[model samples]
Target chain A: MAIPAGITGAAWLLRTVIDARDLTTEVAMVYLAGVLLVASRRSWGPAVAAVLASVATYNFFFVPPFYTFHVADPKFLITFGVMLAVGLTVSTLAVRLQRQADSARERERRTAALFAMTREFAVETSADEVARTLAAHARTLLDCEAQVLMQGPNGDLHPCPSGAPAVDDNELPAAQWAFHYHKPAGHGTPTLPGSSHLWLPLLGARGPLGVLGVQLSARGASLAPSQRELLETYVAQAGLALERVVLAEESARATVAAETERTRSALLSAISHDVRTPLASISGAAATLLEDRASVDESTRRELLQTIWDESESLARLVADLLDLTRLETGTLVARKEPCPMEEIIASAMERMERRLAGRQVRTDLPDEVVVAPVDPVLMEQVLGELLENAVRYSPDTSPIDVVLRREGDLVALQVEDRGPGIAPGEEEAIFDRFYRGAGSAGARGTGLGLTVCRAIVHAHAGRISASNRAAGGAVFRVEIPADAGPGTDRLSPAGAAL
Target chain B: MSPHRPASEHPPGVLVVEDDRRLRATLKAALAAHGFAVTDAASGEEALALAKERAHDVVVLDLALPGIDGIEVARRLRAWSTVPILVLSARGQEQSKVQLLDAGADDYLTKPFGTNELVARLRALLRRAGRGDADPTAAMLIIGPLHIDRAERRVHLDGEEVRLTPTEYDLLAALAKNAGRTVTHRRLLAEVWKDRSEEHAGRLRVYMTYLRRKLERAGRPRLLTTQAGVGYRLNAE
Candidate 1:
């Protein structure tokens, strides 16, 4: 008001002091300056007041009614009207430009904030990381603190471990209810209006995934409509990120389940073939011995009898392997631990395998002192027997098999080496699979259960087993069982002991 | 092998029940040659009928029967008579062993058991049952010209010496001891080594080749014979 008023008074004084009665049209410039000053300094309303004052003052002092309240010339009236129109036009345009600049600035700020949030969301690691990102952004944009609560496995809202505070116990039910119902609750909402925190559900295509609890500043207990809208948008993005995390987890689980099924089916088919092959020979031998007793020569009868015996022995071993797999699957593999000397276990296995390895050279490399460890003797014997059998089966009759036992970094390492063709490239790990045949051995008699059984027994003993191709033209199978450790690795079954 | 089950006073009646038809027939014939009056049955029901209708010294039942398991048969037979139940199961599963033993089976034989072991186990079961008139005890085994004397642990073929390696002698003795029955490869290996091995059953083939060459004179029927995948056997019956 003062700016418009002062500019109008200055123009009136200048017109009076200049003593130029003929400078009537030029005097319009002084009046125009007053209108422009008010438009720039103030709003359009005050500038309009200046416009009306300039028009009236020009009529009273500079118009044809210079001395009287009458227009001496009608042309002077046109001048007064044009001057008034120009003032009004200038003031309106100034205000319109001011509003346009302010709006552009607001839009630019919003776009930049949204872009920052989107970039953060792109590479978010976990549901919790998404929560922190959204929460921090919310605090900045809304000018208030916010807590993000995601639904856990139980469908209850749990705050992320780091960023958000736990939803107060008393208010937890309300937050969960809001997330479940996909509705807002607490302060400013129709429900729970007196509560200090506002809970807004993060709804998605998969229903509500979580909730956002915003803590308003002391300026007011509620957020203005625009701020509330901004909060809703932030929560919506957070919900999307959380949904992505869960979907990724679900897909990974499904893939694992599918892979396990494939492995199980492969193992079953391989076992079935092995079982039938032995059964055919055994049953056929018994039938022939019964039917051809009178006709067949003594030597033929003897041959038939031997067929049944050998097949039955291998069949027994196969059945034992099946039982072992079952026990591992059922988590009932109970090991009876005792201090067993490796030398003793090796000797027992070797002695048992005497008839099988009579002509072959079995070289042994062992440490001098007793390498005693807590293990089930029978199970370890089975492991050694399987490894020795595997070596003999895959390798030629001429090549010697090597068995070495030593201490390796907190473990007792046993390496079984054979000079046969080294494991097929990339098959070092695959050979441990239950159904993985020895592809390297052409027509070798391998059911593939030997190595699988070895791995299982070693793993149950809290050990690691690996197969590697030695540069010396053979494959080395190594088993490292943790030596003399705490009781944590032992699997104790109450029922097994009682039985 | 001489008839261990003597028919001195009255031959003891024995029931043979097995799912495999050929195995059952072979067992019946073998038991008959050993001087026991063997009655054969293909199933548990038929065996139960023979048990009720006829007097038998012992029942040899296979655990894996077509209709009912040997455990159920053992339990049902125990309810009526004091007959000894000898269970022959292919699985040799320890759990089944425990159950069958609890269900009144007097003795259990794992599959591919030697004929000698089967006869010995059954005889021991029968003796305990007090049906001791026909005892099963062999002093010597004679297959054609092949002679095996258990007392001396010696083998004689074709009136000449049939020398054997220490392991070969033990192996031949094990096969001749259970002349007409099956001996598992692992059991035969253990017999040779004096201990069991889960490793190579293939090693037995080398010794078998040697025994076959030594025992088979130019033309006379081969004494020691190969049973393909099974252990060697001397066909005395």
Candidate 2:
């Protein structure tokens, strides 16, 4: 109201200046200019009011008996009629142009929002994450509660957990209807218009993937037509994101399945070959002794019995390796750690491997000071046992095998060095793979799982194990376990009479 | 190995509790061949019943029995009798094996063991039980070349006196009491520290290392041996 009145007062002042020359037509043009200015700058209501005010002021001040509501001549009334016509036309056109600009700005905003949502969805690896992003945007943009109900594996709609607010049980039917028919339903929609929320299907290229429900009525406000279009675009983008996530997940599962199939076949063949060889020897020896005890000579019978014992021992070791590998692969073997003296663990492993290490020059270099480390003693012993077994199996009996233990800063280092051919270059890491037998170790009586089990056990201790060529001409397997100071770790001086 | 019987009119009685039929028969036959009058039971319940019916010199129990588990059986047996229990445990059952030994079991032999090892462990348990009592007040204890004069609290390795700290002496004495047998960590901790908490294990290990260093002699074999996950053992070579 103030803007129209201000424009009318300015037009009156302009008419006062032009009335000296009696340019009545020019005076009317001044009032027309003020009305046009008001129409172009303000809304239609104010602009129309400005037109009526301009005409009244023109008649009372410029057209006749000056300052009265009377016109001197009837021709000036035509001027008033043309002025009103032009003012109304410009006001209508200006309002249409303003509406067009406002809608354009709204469209740009929604487009940017869609771009941001798409970028967010690109990083989302799962359908649940995409739903969460969508719902969060809806809560801020639409100013209402939102939920994205996705179809589960069994084709039933379920809201993504932790992504949206709790959905009303009564509204599920409307949501389901939208999902099935790929149309809008509930309060602001034609179908199920009695429900409190607006449900629209998230359509994909294939079909409706899910339903997006927005509680506009619960917030006591309905979305404008443009806002509704924005919501539909959001739903479409989310649908594509969900489809991408599902496809990626399916492909990943296929890759794992294929890999598992390959491993299964490899394991089966390795087990059959390794297990049958020992079984053959044991059964063959036993059957011979049982069938011909009297015919067999004393020494020959002893030899057969010894073969049975040795082969069964190897068989037992094979079974143990298999069990350990299975436990490690299945993530069932948790390292039960405690502070243990490294020397004690080494001694125990050596004692366990005494028979195999008999007459072999086994040299050990241990620190004078007691080095304590947090480790599962039993598992550590197994790791050392495997390393030692590998050394003795590969190295010559005359060559010395060195076992060195050191405390390097915060880590406990144990290296088993053997005077044998070092690990074949380029196979350092491959040697730790399951069923990986070295080229030189083909006929060696081992299940090929020893190093794999060793790696797994060391990993459980949060330690690392590696094999490399020793500078002095052999292979050295090094294991380093973190020796964080824990309970009962009292640093004492080296014993005076330490060996 | 042959059936070398002890110098007695009656052979030592043995109760073998194992669930697998084949393994039970193998154990029965093997123990019988080693001059043990074997009494076999297929489950822990039958083993308990058999124990009540007769006085077995030693009980050989399988850890994974079907009815009553080995630890429970050992606990129930210790509630009444003093029969030595030798548990036959699998490889990866170290924690349960420790629990079994703590529950009144004397020794354990891991599965896939040689018959000679089984006989040796059984013999050790039988000999320890036959000592009549722990005799904590005994004046002297001798194991191999090492001797402990309990009255004087002095230790000698190879006939030469070796100096030891008080805690070291206690740790050795605890292992010496059950020399040639595997003692669980809990038992040793309770005996030496008088507190069986696990935190004391590190201290026990450190002291054992010190004792080993002190007991080392030129041209002499290793005597104080670590039993891996178990506690120390004084080898009676």
Candidate 3:
């Protein structure tokens, strides 16, 4: 203010020291310089004030009237007009140059902020971390509170596992709608314009990954188009970063799955050698005693005979199960179809385990009319044998075990019921998994392959099998096979099908 | 007990090829005590060399060998002689049984067999071979109008020739051999498709239905009878 005032006053004082006619143009040039200086340094208001003041000074001190309001020479009015025009033009040009410089500086600042945000997002490891970075950067860059949200498996948006500048519960619906529609919602947008925060969807190549919510105040309302563009760029970068984190986690999980498969195969081969060799020795030693009984005493001979018979029975079961399990793991086990009656195979299975069942009550509930089923007799027998063995081992000696056979519309179901403590809740399906032993049978000796092998055998036959607690005490193991038997995939019961 | 009864010998010679050391010794001792002479070999190569040197009435070979598997040994043996090769394999390996049989093995017995089972299978082999002497597949198996000639590997229904798949033929042949008796479902599948998985039984049922449809003559098909809820039998009309 002082510089423009002092320059205009000195230019007027110069008129008294020189010939007014010869100094008029020089005085006019001085007033123009003062206006230009004020305009470059200050904003348009102060610069415009300097322009009007310079024109008034020229009319009063340099016009023909000199120090008076009236002008005698009419041509002096032209001089006055020329001086006013130059002062306004010079100030206007200076103000425009100042605006261009300020805009250039703003561009550099925005670029630096974006570069920093990119570096921050690149180092994030998980989706939560990515969201935190996005929210923090958004709050700083957009001058508002920001929140990030991710979608759950059921298609509902969840606030980032954890982050700050968080979206409140009330804002969740707006964010969700934005995510579902893959567009911006809430304040300023056509959708939900009354919302306090604007929600922008973070869309990736596949689909919308999440949403970003931001709240602005009065200062934010006047943002220029360029400032809004900078905010949009930040949001776009945030979307890409969020996807990068999610994809990385998914790939890591896949890699772990593949590693687990490799480990499982290696363990199976190891089990093959460990199981068969020991079984060979135990059964072989027992066989030697049976074959050479003539050299031994009567008491010793009887024991040897029992030993051979029992060991061979167990050994046969173990060897067969081990081979079958190994083949199943490799996807090499295939079902061979044939016609057979269900009654005889189940009876034979019971007969093999008769000694153990001698003390227990046994009953057979079979149809009066013979039911013929097309099945692999060997495989079905094995499945029934495993189930019966399990019943004998788990049930009390006084409890009765019933073998029930029934026919459904397009399938036949065979069930073995034992009057023992029923299957544990929630563990009914897990018992069929390889190497799973029931909690109640901890002390009972087994390789944990019996029930697992049964399931594989049943599945190969295009049938279904399950274990459940019977309505009247104990557990029931059921198997359902198709009547026509052409690769049928019917379930044994509706309950098993739901599972 | 007589020395000069004109019998071949009091003890039969058996070649036992096994990989496990303890099992091989036990098998040899048990077979020897059962009035049979047994030779032990630890590997397929050793067994091959022993077979080339001396003749044995029967050979028991294990499937899991270090260098050459039992199937290769069976194949190599077929190039020279027809000594009944009895395979020793783990249970539920019916595919291996099929491969061995296709490679010229005569029969198979899963591991952990008692002395009685071993002796029974050997005696069955010897008895069947002695009955024919030169031809094992001699008498034709007849069931109703279906004539199964084992020697020619041909089947005829109602006196008209019938073209059958390998599995179908095997199923019919097994049923015809046990014409008056029931053949267990497991045994039939093991003999025909040589599959031991459970699904094979379901498939077996489908094939049984197919067999009945194919055998229908003038819309009157002879039923393949079943009994005891576990086996199949053919009723000749």
Would you estimate the TM-scores of all the predictions?
A: 0.47, 0.79, 0.46
- Is 1 or 3 the stronger prediction by TM-score? 1
Tell me how many clashing residue pairs each candidate has. Answer: 7, 0, 15
lDDT for model 2 comes to: 0.84
In angstroms, give how far residue A469 of model 3 lies from its true place.
Answer: 4.9
Q: lDDT by residue for model 2 over B1-237, one digit each (tens)?
A: 113435366888999999999999999999899899999999889999999999899999999989789999999999999988899999989888878877878788888999999998888777767664346678888887888999999998778999988888988898887776667788887888787686667667777878877886434677877777777778865
Docking class of 3: incorrect
C-alpha root-mean-square deviation, candidate 3? 17.3
DockQ of each: 0.03, 0.44, 0.08
Mark the 10 consecutive residues where model 1 chain A has the least summed lDDT: A488-497
lDDT score, candidate 3, position A413: 94
| Candidate 3 residue lDDT tens string, B1-237 | 123221355567789999999988988988888777899899999999999999877898999888999999999988997777888887666567667766767667767667777877776555534432322265687666878888777888778888876667778877776553345666787777675654445456545644654675333533475332345656543
| Docking level of model 2 | acceptable
**Ranking under lDDT, best-scoring first?**
2, 3, 1
Residues A1-499, candidate 3, lDDT per residue (tens digit)?
5765687678867866664667867876787677667666777777777767766666776766677758787776776676556656666787787888888888888898888988998998888887778788777877777878888878788877444544667777778789888888877888887778888898778888888888854234644677678878887888898888878989999998998798688657755754665467566757767677678788876776675565556556665677788786567876665556576566556655656676777677977644556677667887888888889888887888899999888888999999888788998998987667788887775557788889888888789999899898899999998877433423222221232
Question: Considering TM-score, which of the candidate structures 1 and 2 is the better prediction for this target?
Answer: 2
Maximum-TM-score candidate:
2
